[model samples]
Target: MDNDRAFMLSHTFLLKSVKPFGEGLWQPGASGAPWRSDAAEPTADDCVCSIAIFTEEPGTIDLDGTSVSLSKGSAIQLRSGGRFSVQSGSGSATGRLAGWLVEFFVFRFGDSRPIAGGFPLLPYHQEIAVHPFAALCSVVDRITRTADGYDDPTALRKQAALLELLALLMENQQRSHMLDNAAAAVKRAISYVRDHYTEPLTVEQLASIAGVGRWQFSELFRRLTGKRPLDYINTIRLNRAKELLLLTDDPLREIAQSVGFRDEYYFNRKFSRMFGCAPKSFARSGKTAASRQPLLPAAKQARVRSSLTGEPSRLVVCGGILGDVLSLGVKPLGAELAVMGRQVVYRDKLAGILDVGIGGDADTIAALQPDLVLLEKEGVAASHFQSAAAPVVSFRRTEDVTVRLRAIAALLGAEREADEWIARHEDAASSMWNRLRSRIGTGETATVLVQIGVQLFVMGNRGLAATLYHPRGFSSSEGAAKLAEGSERFREITAEQLPGYDGDRLFLLFSGDERSKREARQLTETSAWQSLHAFRSGNIHMTEAKWNYDDSLTRGQLLPVLPHILSSRI
Candidate 1:
């Protein structure tokens, strides 16, 4: 990589009031609004030429040798790769005061810099005047109303109005327009390629997404991202493929198709060139894209890149999703996983790893020096470690465990481990099915009953029910289904309704609390409990009271003893 591309740096948003403009998703030709944000500092930009028009001032943009005051109605322009440290005091809208002072991130692509007029624009961070500011505001308001969501006539109107504003601004000596109104066009297209890379991606399709001509989008995308349109698509696809290569045992053809390379051979050649090694070798050795990335960046900076030492890299997991990544056999930098209700008992698996509290201080986390920081959600307190030291990711819990599992697998460079575990699980599950198929038929109904002190509950997709019956296709009793219908996991019920929840098979899950145990022992002895056919006919089983929580680690443990427990041996 060239020095310009390799050493390139950008500013990031620390805090912003900029919601998704124009229909909640950013696309080309859509207009943006003036935003009131509280970004204390910056590390990267939105990969665009930014126009910061300050309507109010509480922030200071720090430069190498000086500081720039973001005074009222003053505007500053920053290009791609420009870095600035700013502190905005969450501006206000009280009585004649503007709620937001800045409207930023416009005219992104470099092609727009050479305007039709010889406008020099103002010096960077020197605070310049913007004439006809109200006219600029009117054009932006029209854009918000005009651009709906696609390549329609409304979008044309929005784009035209925005271009008119750009042209007017370019006429000013302090500000010049770049590429007419195609400022954010290329960045939007690049973002589309990143998000939807798995789909059928072509230059023409991306251009359409950007609302630009095929040739125009192609040329501009190359200039901004430093790769051809198709090449950029391939970069995303094969990068994901490398993850799957390490994470899944699926066939090459299937992996290829999954990552958008229908032809396995073509993918193989590209992978070889990109990584300097074949796919199989890479997976077996757990080689990452870092084997070919600029070593200085990954080594010198903490940007969530992998280590070449041939093992899962050290990680820092913040939030409750610790179990998801832990189940992949990847040890994190922290001491132990966070303790939520009922999950404290499963902490033994984190034997070698140190246990860190969920609310660890920011300084302590930075001292641990994790390579990647995984947040359960975007609002995790651990996000403070997102500096030049480590990359912080918010891995939200998705509907599918495979999506979550595969993503974490790639991140930790545990693809082989993941693939092996998955294959082993499939085999065990299949064997279990074959063993019980003769005994448990398709017509059989299974229901999980929970006892916690005086609380009687029914289980749904969360606890043992998801493992025992959801994938196994066991039917829920009429009452059990009805009881769990309103809840995603467990629903508490009255003791009088326990008999109605009984199915062909009954599993007793306890909360393990003292009150639950005492109440359960007393209740099971009652005639009301013994009246159920499943309870009296040797079809009832006792399950681990504490393993009812959802997570990959707990689920993996359940798979091993599942058949034995189902046979009433437990």
Candidate 2:
């Protein structure tokens, strides 16, 4: 129940390499060490966490006696005790091969174990290897330089950078795996549930689509995804029901049958449980509010028209990561807001956009003829904002429903609407907060970590309404530390170099395909995971990527159910 432990478990890290080695070379041994195929495999005593980026030279690798040839842009891993040997050419050519080797070692102290079939790490392949690798190198160089310049090598500043790198790597790997396995039969099952939730779907039917027996499919799905097929199916149906209730004027019974519920009474019961309100009440209240609101005033409508036709006013957004702006929701918001307001705009770069050559492009902004611009205060320089003619406003990102809505409202000139939205949102958020606060009651609070990729950034508890409910109080480990100094990119880390973050609660955000799922499963099953309080109490939660990244009305549809998922663990 230690709050510190809970906070640490919820943080994550990301690491990317800036200068990846060129293609066509054998995997180099440790730093300054040459390849030795005949060398004895390292034993458990010699095992350490290591991550390497190497280019294969159109040669074959002997994987535990099975020969598998690797292609360029392939990422390969070397486990603590697992041994693999690679030869340079198809037949004869040996000597010194061409290519570069960048190795990252992650060292975790105290009890640590590998995940995913003992091959805890995998290669991330991009169609063009140059960009992703280059991004990684940039992140690594920045982190290393920052760490070196610190007056104290083991200073809190260095730890923060290292944590962020870890979260970033974990998220990158998870996301890549998710994309790769999006077409798998298991994923097909998920898609089917999403598309046909309105229709009755039995376990047998879902299992057929997944190409497995009902029992086997159920077990496998739960093991890989942390939720049973039936639970996931019901969750989807309930989500759709909520959407229809909010967006449409359909009657309660009709909406109930539309989402596969057999009876209106049963639907109302379930809806109230999920959303803390009955369907009829929710719909009626929402309708009343909409009916009461007045349309845009004549003067305001004229101003909007004038702004569109005359000199466009520039709008600038600041203080968010690169990924925040590049997300599907944010991107469309930018375009729609721009068209509506008629102005030049600037936005922060989050995730991979910085490396995609989109940051600070003057020509692109010029073509849009925007008078205003938005940029992340932390990610962009003062010189970058000097050219903008419009006002630049800075805002912070947080989980607090009120803060986020207010920020968006202020930006879009819809503060009154934002206030209404906040009130409704607060009604739900506040109730949950009260329930959580009563349970915590000056007792030790649980620490939680949220994994991104290799970077281990902590979520801010101060701005999060949920934490306020806990009487014992909660805080982020990174709250007092200085922001990690680096370019906006993924950083690299060896498994051995990862820090020990045993906490009371663990929330994982996996970003890759089936491989990443397997890795996460392996991590969960390990002895290290079992030893943690969160693991023992079953307080771990895996959130959907769409829910985590998408910031549209769709997100609102999912928000009410979050407290149920998190609080159920307690």
Best by lDDT: 1
- Backbone clash count, each prediction separately: 21, 96
Q: What is the lDDT of residue 493 in candidate 2?
A: 31
Where does candidate 2 stray beyond 4 Å? 1-360, 385-388, 396-408, 432-444, 452-503, 545-558, 567-570
Instruction: Report the error of model 1 at residue 376, Å.
Output: 3.1
Locate the minimum summed-lDDT window of 10 residues in model 2: 479-488
- For model 1, residues 412-520, the per-residue Cα lDDT tens digits are 5566666556545544554455434434656678888787656778876566676665434467877767644544466777767777788888888766666665666
Overall lDDT per candidate, in order of appearance: 0.56, 0.43
Give the alpha carbon lDDT tens digit for every residue of 198-237 in model 2. 8888889988888776776786565444358877677666
Mark the regions of model 1 whose C-alpha exceeds 4 Å error after superposition.
1-305, 308-313, 335-348, 358-364, 377-389, 470-473, 478-487, 496-501, 511-518, 526-533
